[model samples]
Target: MTSIKTKKILSKAGYYIFVSLLAFAMCYPLIWMLCSSFKETNTIFATATSLIPDPFVLKNYPNGWKGFGGISFATFFKNSGFVTVLSTIGIVASSTVTAYGFARIRFPGSKIWFSCMLLSMMIPFQVLMVPQYMMFNLFGWTGTYLPLIVPSFFINGFGIFLTVQFIKGIPRDLDEAAKIDGCSTYTIFLRIIVPLIVPAMVTNGIFAFIGKWDDFMSALLYLNKPQQYTLALALKLFCDPSSTSDWGAMFAMAILSLIPVFLIFAFFQKYLVEGISASGLKG
Candidate 1:
């Protein structure tokens, strides 16, 4: 028994060591990028083998911020922020309403419709990209933020699925009790159901925000006007085929881009995990 216990301890220690190494490997690139962003251009290449920056510098941030097409990085940040916030709000509101109906309300062909929604999640975005672009062009919505913000008002498959799972975990007794208290469905939904599902709503909103913030392909395909370019698109402005690449500034911008995502995740991480966990539990 003592030998078996020792073996189990060794196995657990080995498992933790493996996990720690894997974590370090995954995080190394990000760490390297951040360190390089603070180093001088020459030092970056010279110290390529070293992860630590000897002479730390912060000039890359200001240079990158002011360097992109003579436009300040603040403008790009504003554009990205506007689109991300609007998209997240629209997605959360629409998905919540749609998920509530699917989970609680009985309507004609609801099951089939719900199944169809699930199937839509399986379809790749590439398949719909061209058609969507054509449709946006027909509406003359290209080169504007409308193409990014408008579709979010419609139900998103992942958001709907997440919300539906959360709502399903809610006990029907709450609704019945609210009804007995002369509360209307709208009131119950707005006041009670929404509050109860705060975790899920927060999770979905965070997910939507991150997606809109990080989106590159959609922004690249639709946004033609330079002024309307998001931070993700603006990051590519540093690329020049003939000139030496501004690796330091590019890395700085890349690191800057991650700040908002990290903040959002940190703020909502608890609720996101809770929502996911609760959704999987039996009511």
Candidate 2:
């Protein structure tokens, strides 16, 4: 019995050590980038494997913030905030309502609609990008944030699917109880369903915020003005294939861009895990 206990302890220790090594390997690129941001631009490539900067400098932050063509990096951050926040709100609202309908209300073709939503998730975004661009351009929304924000108000495939799964897990008796108490469908949804599903909504919001915050292709395809650039788009400006690139500033801004993502994950990870686990979709 003692030998068996010792073997189990040793196995657990070995598993943890392996996981720690894998985690460090996965994070090494980010760690290197952080260190490179502090190093002089000329030596960044020279000290590729080093995690410590030889001569630390604060110039990268200032230079990156200065931005280009008289626009400040603050503008990019603001634009990202505007688009991402609105988009997240839109997705959560739209997806929750759609999910509730599909889950509780037995309408004609509801299963068909649910299946379609799931199918949408299987289709890659690249498959629809060009046609979507042309449609938005026809509506005269190119060069604006409308193209980015409006579609989110209508539908989000993964968001709807996630939420539908979550709502299905909720017992229908509460909804029936609310109805028997003379509550309208909308009132039941608002008073009973919404409150209980707050965790799922928060998960959606966190994902939507992170996804939209890191969006580069949507901004690249629709936005033409530098003032309208997002952090992801503005970061691209640091690299000029025909001219000298500012690697230090790019690395600095990259680190800053990741801060919000890290913070959101840290604070709301419990909700994320709970929502996914409850939804019956966890892999």
Among these predicted structures, which one has the highest lDDT?
2
TM-score, candidate 2, is 0.96
TM-scores of all candidate predictions against the true structure: 0.93, 0.96
The residue-by-residue lDDT of candidate 1 on 1-283, one tens digit each, is 9999999999999999999999999999999999999998778988988988889899998899885556788989999999999999999999999999999899999999999999999999999999999999999998888999999999799999888999998889999999999999899899889998999999999989999999998899989977889999999888878988888999999999999999999988999899888876734
Off by over 4 Å in 1: 1-13, 42-46
All models: lDDT?
A: 0.91, 0.92
lDDT of 2 by residue, 6-114 (tens): 9999999999999999999999999999999999988999889788999999899999999999999999999999999999999999999999999889999998988
Name the top TM-score candidate.
2
lDDT minimum window of 10 residues, candidate 2: 274-283
User: Candidate 1, residue 120: CA error in Å?
Assistant: 1.4
